[model samples]
Target chain A: MNPALVALFMIGFTIAAYIGSLHLYRKYRRIYTTPVIVATAVIIVFLLLFHVSYETYMIGGKWIDRLLGPAVVALAYPLYQHREILKKMLVPIMTGTTIGAVVGISSGLLLSKWAGFSTEIIHSIVPKSVTTPVAMSISESTGGVMPLTAVFVMIAGIGGMLIHPLVMRYSGLTHRIGRGVGMGSASHAIGTAASMERDTLEGSISTVAMILSAVIVSIIAPGLTLLLL
Target chain B: MFKDKAIIIPIQIAMLYLIYLAGKGIQNLFDLFIPGSVIGLLILFTLLSLKLVPEWILQQGVSFMVRHLPFFFIPATVGIISYAYVFKGKGMLLIVIGLFSTALVMALAGRVTQWMVKRREEA
Candidate 1:
């Protein structure tokens, strides 16, 4: 097949999946409705059914990857919008986000090691808490598998977003800020989306938390990987 | 918001690429653990401090992007098809570890923030 044709398939598949996922979310309004999950499912099946090589998909898929930086930078809008709330909750948000980022990385490192995974796998697991782009960068810096790190991030993001309501309901953790900060710090962007489902305040706060955690974790992940991993 | 601001996407993309290059330059020079995009983020965020981009431009750009944020990640997510074999055996274990660590982070971070806020209220 022509390379351009392959790229078109990749692009068409992604756009269609995203549109379908958006419609599903509009109707269902659940985490399962998220475009990430739906697109992932559709793309996987599309690949298998068509027998397309991952490399061919990546030819155009990499265009999306390149946008990640700008996408991340775009997130600054919400962070900027939430500036006042950030100022108000600076102390606790910082302390809590930092603690969460550290615990998230350390636990991933320790657990992967305890589970008897290889050192390389463990490195991939270490930055599971941060956002995807940043986590991939950390993974590469520390010699972790790039693709694996992205998988781990989506897993962690989806898990945290889904599990938080249950955690709040059962654990008696009811504070709005508590929930938002926890989800954002632990889960990053997807978690922020989940937080947004509740109200604007939680959403904005979560966005800020995810932003702060991205910067903080990126700074510290290398050191943490060294001392602990 | 979409009418006039839609034009800003090109400008935003240009800014994003420039910021990325700045980050990439710093990255190559120093061998930092962070990615160029992140340093791009830092530069962008600090640039945010300067208030150069109009508020509507920033807001509209972000909102449009955020709505379709997951679209941008489909490639990376689907790229996992390449590494399916890596998780062939230990897939369950890796995912379990991932979930457990996430749960712990949520639990600890939430509890700590709640406790600190309560203490402040008491004070």
Candidate 2:
């Protein structure tokens, strides 16, 4: 198979899976759940069954990954637009992110240690809640494997997607700003996307929180690693 | 309007490269400290906050990414294949811990932030 052609198939397979699952989700909303999740699972299974290499898959998929930085940079506009609201909530946002970051890293480290995880695994697991790119970087710096960090980040994202709504309902958090900040900070990008389904204000704030959380974790992870390790 | 679009693309790309360079510079400084991308994000945020880099550039790049961002995960998703063996040994435990803890922390963070904001408003 021509490499270029194979790449095309890869793209097609991903889109097709997404579309198919979306169709199913719309048709059977209650039973089917999120189309993206279903589609991602299907794609993973297909790839594994065929023994496809991640390198090959990425060659075709990197066109999308390259956009991540730019997308992150673009978030500035929404933040700019919401500058007034951001200014009002700046103290709460910063303080909350700091406390959340500390608690998150500490709890993971403490629990994993108590559970008798290996030192390396404890290091790998500590930054799992942050965004993938940052988490992978922290993992690399601290001698954790990139693949492990990536999987950890993905699990964190999915968990956020599944549980955030329930958390919101249980806590009775109706305010748009509060809800957005919570989702964005905790879940990272996936949670940010989930926030979009609620409203624009929530989405924008969530985006800000996602970006901020990534920034905060990246800054704090290394120092914390040294102290904990 | 036509002039604005004409002016925007070059400026945006230049800004991106500059941001990339700034990120690189920070990475170099922190080579003994942390990852470059993390440094890069911080630099980018600082630039945006200071208004040193115009909002238009960051806006164009961020919007494009957010809309089509999920596709980016495909590449990283490939990591699963490469590290299947590593995952086989302890992946399940790691996944469970990652999931539940992330949910717990996020919920707590959100609730705390909400409470703080409410308290501030009342005061």
Task: Name the candidate that leads on lDDT.
Answer: 1
Residue-wise lDDT of candidate 1 within A191-222, one digit each (tens)? 87667656656776676678678778888888
- Per-residue CA lDDT of model 2 for B57-89, tens digit only, reads 456545544454454455555455565565565
**Local accuracy of candidate 2 as per-residue lDDT tens digits, A1-229:** 7888877887788778767876787788742266557767787788778888777776666755554554455444555566788888888877766666776787777777776788788878877777776788788877776777777777677677777777778877777777887777777776776676557677777776776777788788778867876
Question: What TM-score does chain B get in every candidate?
Answer: 0.75, 0.68
Q: Which model scores highest in DockQ?
A: 1
Query: Which 10 successive residues of model 2 chain B have the least lDDT summed?
Result: B32-41
Question: How far is A160's C-alpha from truth in model 2 (Å)?
Answer: 0.9
Model 2 misplaced regions, further than 4 Å: A20-32, A222-229, B1-64, B81-91
Listed in order, the DockQ scores are: 0.56, 0.39
